[model samples]
Target: MPMSALRFAAVAALLGVALAPAAAQAHRSWLAPSATVLSGAQPWVTVDGAVSNTLFYADHVPMRLDGVKAVGPDGAPVAIQNGATGKYRSTFDVQLASPGTYKIANVSEGAMASYKQGGETKRWRGAVGQLATALPKDATDVQVTYSSRRVETFVTAGAPNTTALKPEGKGLELEPITHPNDLVASEKARFRLLTDGKPAAGVEVEIVLGGVRYREKGPELKVTTGADGVFEVSWPEAGLWWLEATVQGADASGARKSSGYVATLEVLPD
Candidate 1:
């Protein structure tokens, strides 16, 4: 190969190595709202859910709607309308009955176990309560892991409020100091990470702008929570962005558990 060809190959090899970790996590799950802020007597917002290599592109698979839910500004359960699943994405709509913010999320939790029964290894996945019956009576050397995940977005009918943004205190969640629907480009926004309702410190969060398919590389920002579980970011530009984080610890019963949180935020131009 010519000297120029050799250099190009070397660069490509290095790039691949650097991106290996990212590729492993390339399939990102998110919920995208058509509009974050709205005004009217009755306002409605449509949302799309998908798992894709590029943010909000919906190329991989549709996110299941079984775990999707919504909360009104008064902390009441809001109904999802016109929910449908397609080949690459799931679609749903929420009507803003009251003039405040609404929280829409897809939440899921489950446990996995591996054990030896009759000198054979077996694995089981289901709700934690079913472990007793799912595992054989003679099962030995059992190990169980619990996991929880939440993907969320915010929509405001008139003004944003904190009622719907309250943390459930049971899993990984985002407590926004700056309203999620009020993000502005070049302005600083602060958020806190929580695990089981308490401050989660030293957690790493990955933020990336949407429309990755249109660019050579998507712009990404990485931030870590402080001792108080707070992190700040100044938006580089105006667009839809995705933020994700994960934390691992033991649950109340002393079983290993992992929790993950993902949010899609829309930033407005300043």
Candidate 2:
């Protein structure tokens, strides 16, 4: 009885150990990049990483954008906004007011099924913790992160296009400039432009003196940009000349007139 009883107890214990229920674990995973930086007149941030889940069960996940912050040499939080995407991917952009330091955090609730390095599904994850680092500053060194991920990883490692908001808040105080708004006898008025205490050279200069008699000579003359982008022309007679100068391009609106600044010049009647 003693030997049989002992063997039976040993066998019973072994079966119980094998039959016990296994615990269930849930893993929340998103994505992350090694480094991110904020630079440029506007400001930008990026996250580089891969998802723990291989299946990408939730094609769509919500991400929290941070780092829209800064501190004076004293310390203060700069206000910023997390832009919206019209597609399924999650990304964020903010227009920095000035410049400083900042950070960004990303989180996901539901994760995709986990896959083995052999390209097989051995486990599944329900939750995962994913975060990205960012440094936003003005005139600062930018950090870039490079990643090597398996094609099967369910994540948007691909970067989306980024753009800056048109400069606001008294953008670039560019005072309207002017060329020599004057003219003498019918010879191009050797004129240079003026702006912000600098020569407005290399910009088109227009000379309009309507008081000239229209014989065989033209009353109005116009010149385009030359050296320094400024050109010159002559006038038939010098009097009160109506002059208009403009430099077309991206600096000022593509399609804008005068930029709301004009000048007047008097020509000696020759």
Question: What local lDDT score does residue 270 receive in model 1, on the 0 to 100 scale?
Answer: 100
Candidate 1 colliding pairs: none
| Model 1 agreement with the true structure over 204-235: per-residue lDDT tens digits | 89999998676777678999999999999999
Query: What is the RMSD, in Å, between candidate 1 and the native fold over all Cα?
Result: 9.1
Work out the TM-score per prediction.
0.90, 0.26
- Which candidate should be chosen as best, given TM-score against the real structure? 1
Best by lDDT: 1
Where in model 2 is the C-alpha error above 4 Å?
A: 1-183, 194-202, 211-218, 248-261
Q: On residues 1-270, what C-alpha lDDT tens digit does candidate 2 reach at each position?
A: 112444533432221111221001121123232122334554443332212121112233333333122222113433434544323334433334444433222211222122233333232222223212122222122211111101100111122111111111221111212222123466555544444334455555444543334334335556655545334555667554444443322223222111211223445556
- In terms of TM-score, how similar is model 2 to the real structure? 0.26
